[model samples]
Target chain A: MTFVAATGRAFLVLLEATGALAIFTASALSHSVRPPFYPRLILRQMVDIGYYSLPVVGLTALFTGMVLALQSYTGFARFQAEGAIATVVVLSVTRELGPVLGGLMVAGRIGAAMAAEIGTMRVTEQVDALTTLSTNPFKYLVAPRLIAGLTMLPLLVLVADVIGVFGGFLIGVYRLDFNPASYISRTWEYLEAVDVISGLVKAAVFGFLIALMGCYHGYRSRGGAQGVGTATTNSVVSASVLILVTNYLITGIFFSTK
Target chain B: MPDSTPSQPAATPKIRLRGVRKSFGPKHVLNGVDLDVGTGESLVIIGGSGTGKSVLLKCILGLLEPDGGRIEIDGEDTTHLRPRDRERVMRKFGMLFQGGALFDSLQVWENVAFGLIQGERMGRREAKDIALRKLAQVGLGKEVAELFPAELSGGMQKRVSLARSIATEPEIIFFDEPTTGLDPIMSDVINDLIVKCVRDLGATAVSITHDMASARKIADRIAMIHQGRIVWQGHASEIDRSGNAMVDQFVHGRADGPIQMEILHP
Candidate 1:
């Protein structure tokens, strides 16, 4: 009986959370299309979400690609398939590693900052002040963030894909003694447009999830400092998990065979 | 005289709340409160901590939805208004929050001009000029206009918040704990500024504070809330002579009275 009760409670919590997120998403999307658009606010968010995040996302992609190349060489050499390293590196980075890893890294950096800043505004009555001042908090705060995240993450993932493939190329040539020209040709030959396009689609979804989670948690935060801290942690954790889950689901849709 | 009777029917209330109720889970905060503020009247609500004064104000401000009841502004039923209608109604309001609640990211002038630019659709140059004048009204210099909220002291921040609230020359203003964390002198200074600002705007003002000095200085009439109900409300001068035990206890800062603090027993 207790097990049944606990399961029911968990299901109920999930349902409530889903409902809240759906409503928030609708509000954000609707407001983004409405007038009184704050171009300045949107541009500022773009800088915060997209430009400032370049170094961390770039480094993560570069290192992941390098390590992937080295590890694939070690394993494939045992199977007498060392020449497949370039194809594997390019495909994996463009289709999987680049968007997923970059999304997770950005979820940590930008998602957490959004939660902290918005949560502080919530606790301090600044949000309430916005309402009194005749500005819709959702339109003023959440819409710009959603717009920036929706547009910016794909750009970041595209850059990450290029940097990651470059990292793999350097490793294949310098460490594994592969001919640099053939390695480069093989990477380009196997890399279809679908691989890069699918990753970018996933990047867009991950971006939306990150911004939505941050704004949702922060807007609902109660108490004070402790609540803001909890919101920040929840934003990053939820966004990272959602990114991984959705990545798998999206991958299945793009690549699964009947 | 107390003037507790409803005003003449010809003069509609600037704000009217009838049987308004709000609750958070099982803890009922505002349980059917009824109050009215005449046009251009300054009404201050005084209560102990956690007595739902802020909740009451938020309900009227459209920041919180009441569980049940009607809130009328200038005889218009503002309860349960749609988003667009709510925004239309909110244009008449200005608020000075307890912690100042100034946007730390914006300079003081920008903070004052936020509503002017964002809500009124005024040009930046014109709004900044008006922001400067409002700052001057609050006794803040033009030098302070370029600084952020974090750079200013608490008193200065409060003054800046006061300036922002009055920047639009709103028809209604709400002050939430206008002197909570200030020293006595600063509190009195804020009280004086509030009184002057409300008078100068001829605005209907609703303020919630536990500061009796502030209440006395700014309020034409005062209401005391206990357990989500207005227990006693009268002219500010009649507060001491009202003969209500709860009002007396709260007004005199007494520990022993009908109103008991909930201290946990070991």
Candidate 2:
């Protein structure tokens, strides 16, 4: 690509991102302030998006943490720094991997599903029927997903944190032959409440991104079957990309050494 | 018999659209369209494929906002109602979707009761009772009520859609392509059911379709939409004397007429 063409493309992408962010901000504000709120709707979304999602998210987190420990043990053992294993696992989960990986997994699972469901509704005019029936599509459709996502992802990450730390614990206790008490103590010694809070904050933001991307693309989808499929693809891809990008930015804000 | 829809009181047009224009990029769908549907009247709008009949119906329903125009229902302007207000207006309507649009996650009874339970906030027991009653009105037995939409045949699904549309007993109902793809006999059966149920409720009916037979059987009056505008309209019998070439060509289903189909080749 030529310089000018690439620069123009980059600028266009930034503009698109800014527009999307603006829409997300507006909807979030609308959702929080809007009356006629349905507590039942929020609960239902929580059950659907959070409870039903537990098994898959659980499995992903358990394996990721175990693998992270195993990989770190091997890398640090070469430098005779294996005692730093707990520190490495805790920092990685708290700072980078937990929210990013959790968001990506849910993006693949929840984001694609949301887009497909909403996109199908859009195509079949169910969305219009909802509109005519005196229901806000944003409040009825988008809000539940956003609130569900904002809340559900944190719960998912909390589970991932436990299972992930446990996975590291199991590896350290059994395979690495590190003292279990020492490893546990090391994991908590320097772990401020800020670390856990930062991870959770990232989780909530990632959840919001997943739903925003999914709903925006799905609601705006045109054409027919092919269009729904494209919307689903875009939802997952954009959500996953945004999760990773936001993870870095958030990590810089929370844990920068200066 | 000009049976005034008693519910609307005949004081105002049930629906009015003035100079409504809609376009997608360069292709204009509705252009300076002006039309009115009388209270309690069954007005069937017939046009060929891509003639913007569906778009016009959607605009009236507030499903698609017209780029320029006013839409008033019962003398109250609805052209600029917010999402919530539009929904309130929508609650006054019932729609029989072209594809039935039943919720697959819900059972037949639940699909019918969706508006009652979800939109109207009716209790489940009452909603189901009303759903079953409406289902029976559409000739669907209670045995089919518990089944999901996927488990039913196309005819049964269409019947379920009809049942759902009338469940709330709204003042106005819109049917989009009521008999688009059903077999001839089945189509006639659905048409008859539509007439019977509509007359039973005394609801004002507006339907958009290309099915001349279906339109003839159900419409008390007929409006022919052509090129995003109403070309000729009159009583069902008067369609024969509309004298407008476009209306004649459409009623006769002729390819040779003032209307031209733009076939695009990529």
Candidate 3:
């Protein structure tokens, strides 16, 4: 009976969390469409989430690509398929590594920042002040962030994909003994449009999840400084996990064969 | 100084809360709160920390929903207002929060103009003009307007918050623990500014504070809350002579009385 009760409680907690997240997402998206849109706030958020996050995301993508190229050369050489290194590097970077790694990096940077900021605002009664001033916090705070996340992640991922492929190219030419021209051509040959598009779609979804989790946790935070810290941690963890889960689900949808 | 009686039978109260209840899980914050503030009256709710005074104010402001009760603003039921209606109703309100609650990202003038620009859709230039005027009214200099909230001193931040709250010229204003962390002299200064601002605008003011000096200075009527209920209410002058033990204990900051601090036993 105790075992059943514990399972039931766990299921209920999961259900409640999902329900709350769904409601928050719905409200935020609806507010984004509504009138009295705050263009300046949206632009500011775009810069914060997208532009400011570029260096970290770009660096992560570059390193990941380089390591992937080196690792693939080592493995494929054993199979007497060293020439396939460029194709492997490009395909893996575009299809999986670029979006996933970049999303995780941003989940750490932007997600934590958003949660900390909004949570501090929550504790300080700034959010309540916004309400009193006739501003719906969903519209004023959440919508701009959600919109920025949804739009900016794809752009970031696209850049990450290019940088990541470039990283692979440098490794294949300089580190490995592959001809630079043929290595570049090989990367282009196997790289279908679907590979890049699917990654970008996943990037967009990951972005939305990151922003949603941050705003949701932060907005609900209480108990002051400790609460803000907890919210920041929760936002990054939840966003990173959601990005991985959604990546698999999205990959299955785009690539699964009957 | 005319004492504004708590809801005269002849006039409709500007704000009214009856049997308002709020709780967080097992702990009941507001068991049942009942109060009324007359139009253009400055009503200060006096209570110790965690007595649901802030919760009561939030409920009335529609920032928190009451579990069970009716809240009426201007004789209209507002307990369960929709988001659109809530926003519409909120247009009539302005609030000065404890801890200043100034937007740290914005310049002092921008913080003051936030309501005007965002809420009323006023042009930036016009809002800036009003913001500068409001800042001046709060005794802050023109140079102070360009500085951010972090750059300002605590007193200056509070002054900026005051400017922001009144920027929209709201019909009703709320000051939540207006002098909680201020020095005695600064607290008195804030109390005076609040009194003057409320008087000049002829606006209905609701303030919650544990600061006796602030309550005495600003309140036309004072209500004391204990354990989520208003224990004693009367004109500010009557507070000293009110025979209620709870009110006496709280007003005098006494450790021994009907109201006992909940200290854990070893």
Over 4 Å off, model 2 = A1-21, A32-35, A38-41, B1-11, B263-266
* Model 1 per-residue lDDT tens digits across residues B88-169: 8999999999899999899999999999999999999999999999999989999999999999999999999999999999
Which stretch of 10 consecutive residues in model 1 chain B shows the poorest summed lDDT?
B1-10
- Please give me the total number of clashing residue pairs in predicted model 1: 0
Go through the candidates in order and give each one's DockQ: 0.90, 0.58, 0.85
What does candidate 2 score on TM? 0.92
When 1 and 2 are scored with lDDT, the better candidate is 1
Best by DockQ: 1
CAPRI-style grade of the A/B interface in model 3: high
TM-score-best of 1 and 2:
1
Tens digits of lDDT, candidate 3, B1-266: 34566647348888988899999999999988888888898999999989999889989999889999999999999999988898899999999988889888889999999999889999999999999999989898899999989998898899899999999999999999999888999998898899888888999999999999889999999999989999889989999999999898888999999987899879
Runs in model 3 with CA error above 4 Å? Answer: A1-5, B7-9
**Candidate 1 RMSD computed on C-alpha atoms after optimal superposition onto the true structure:** 1.7
Error of 1 at A12 (Å): 2.7
TM-score of each: 0.97, 0.92, 0.97
For A80-187, candidate 1 gives per-residue lDDT tens digits of 998899999989999999999999999999999999999999999999888888888999999899899989999999999999999999999999888999999999
